[model samples]
Target: MMKTAVIYATKTKHSKKLAQAIGLFLDITVQNITENPVLDDVDLLFIVGGIYGGASMPELLAYIKTLEAPMPKYAALVTSCASGSQKQIAVCNILEEKGIKVLDEFVCKGRILFVSATHPNAKDLKAATDFAQKIVAGGLK
Candidate 1:
């Protein structure tokens, strides 16, 4: 079996839900980055998080930096954001700098818990899950 790790940072659980969906599809272990994950035995790593303001959570960056494994063949990034911004690119850049090959990047509309009026609903969740399925099926490559 292909070893996969799904690490995510989520404040209100939107990102965590998406990560779980991806994990279900890939049959991998899912973890929260805040809990301190060890990536040594993972063959494929999927980093998932949310974009706050215009960037990803600092903890996610820190976790990425702490990773000690050699670049994996498939590294995927998933983010829950209000819209498609540079956050995904920033994540891709960081992973690339670490010599990790990024295979796909996925983003979906997320609810802003602070600003409850602009939150994503069930439709958005479905869209995100569909995107995750595509990534797992190699459609995002």
Candidate 2:
């Protein structure tokens, strides 16, 4: 079996929820990067998080810098204010700099956590899950 790991940072659980859905589809483990940073054992790594103020989370960036895993297949998922914008492109560039080969990138609209009373409703959740399936099927790559 192809071993896969979903490593992510989540503030309001939207990204985490998406990761979990992906993990279920791929039969892989879901790890929160804040609680864990070591990913040496994972064969395929899926980095999931949100784009905040045009960049990835600081903690996620730090973790990526410290990673020493063999150049495994890598992919990224993000909840963003605008999909496929400069922020997403920046994230892809950063991952490439870390020597992680980005296979595909997926993005979904996310409501500003503190500024919005409501966010990531059911429809958004479904979109995330569907995207996860696509990644697992190698359709995104």
Candidate 3:
């Protein structure tokens, strides 16, 4: 079996909730980027975070930068934003530049201040979990 890991950087807990759901469905542990977890021998890594100021958190991007040579073989993204936009192009670029193949990304509405206030709720968690399952079953890495 492939080793998998789920790491998330969240400000309003939307990304955290989704990461936890995916970890639970995959029977893996969910890690907060604040923990500074390192990916070692990870076949598939799930990067979960929320958009702020129309971009991924700086902390997350920095952490991704640190994952150079030891980077996972494959990666997938999960993002949340008030706009419900799936534009984490910056993060995608970094991962690709690190030679980590980005298999896919899943985006959902996230609570950002007053917007998307009801997001990352039960429905969102289910979708995130389903998406993770699909990625695993779809032969990622």
Candidate 4:
């Protein structure tokens, strides 16, 4: 059986909620990136974070840099925000530079600060889960 890890960082809990939904769908435990940053044993890795000022969480980026050499073979990126696509390229670039093959990416609307706080609703969570399932079916190689 292939081993998978669902890790994430969040400030307003939007990313955490999304990560948990993916974890439940994938039958994998969700872990905070700060608590469990090492991924030496995971066959497939999914990193999720919220977008702030057009960038993923700084802590997440720092943790990615700390990953032991020889990054995981298959990895996916997930980001959430009002725009969803915000800061995706920056995170994708960081993972690609680490020699990790990014297999897929998912972005969904999240509750923006105090502006538009109604997000990550049923629709968004369903979309995230669907994305994760597709990535799993694509093979973790």
Candidate 5:
């Protein structure tokens, strides 16, 4: 029974919504990255955010830097332009640099500006919840 904390930064609310879905599935509360979340007592942490300018939101990365050394067990979640391939890589590199074991990653669809619209909708939220459930059930193995 791991105590998990979800920290996310979202501009358009898509990432926040995904974090909420995951938090709801895990029975945990979702905290915004701007709120300066702590993970001392948490067994698992979910770093979630939206991609911007071909990378993750600056606020999210900045928050991650404020964490103490020997970072806790964690995973990455993102609502990005594509499938979050680039964002995941960037995040994983940062986490791994701190010797943190990144268990897994989850990516949900997001609406791009004036490009592909209608994302992070009902279906996306459902998928996010389903992904969270599976991740929780598997214990990040």
Candidate 6:
């Protein structure tokens, strides 16, 4: 079986919760990037985070930069942002630059104070799980 890991760099807890849901779905533990977790030979990496000021957190991007080639051979992005637009292009680009194959992405509404406050709800969690399952099941490649 291919080894997989779920990691998140989150300002708000929404991304952490989404990572937790995906972790639970896949029976794996979710990691926080702020903790400076190191990955080793990960076959697939699920990078979960939120968009702040129209971009992914610098912390997340920096962590992604630290990842060298071949440890994470593949990646899937899971994002929580008010725009809900599969809009983590920076994250995608960095991973690709490192030669990590980004298979797909999952985005859902995230709370911005009163805006989208009800988001990352049950429906979003379910969709994130489904997306992860499809990636692990090789549905993306």
All candidates: TM-score: 0.80, 0.77, 0.95, 0.91, 0.87, 0.94
| Residue-wise C-alpha lDDT for candidate 5, range 1-141, written one tens digit per residue | 577788888888888888887888778889998789878756677777777777877777777777795457666554545443445566777777776677777676687765547777788878877877776677754
Encode model 2's per-residue lDDT on 85-129: one tens digit a residue.
Answer: 434565567678877677766677666645433556666667766
Q: List pairs with backbone clashes in candidate 6.
A: none
**lDDT value for model 5:** 0.73
Misplaced by over 4 Å in model 2 are 82-86, 113-118, 139-141
- Residue 122: error of model 4 in Å? 1.1
> lDDT of all predictions, in order shown?
0.73, 0.67, 0.89, 0.82, 0.73, 0.89
The TM-score obtained by model 3 is 0.95
Q: Compose the digit string of candidate 1's lDDT tens values, residues 1-141.
A: 556788899877888888887777666768998889877656667888888878888788877777675545567887788664435667788888887788777676776645434545666556666766665666322
Angstrom error of the Cα, residue 76, model 2: value is 3.2
Which regions of candidate 6 are displaced past 4 Å? 139-141
User: Per-residue CA lDDT of candidate 3, range 34-113, in tens?
Assistant: 89997888999999998888889999999898885667989889999888885688999999998999999999998766
| Candidate 3: segments with Cα more than 4 A from true spot | none
> Any residue pairs clashing in model 5, and if so which?
none
Question: RMSD to the native, candidate 3?
Answer: 1.2
Please provide the root mean square deviation of candidate 1 (C-alpha atoms, Å): 2.8
Ranking 1 against 3 by TM-score, winner: 3
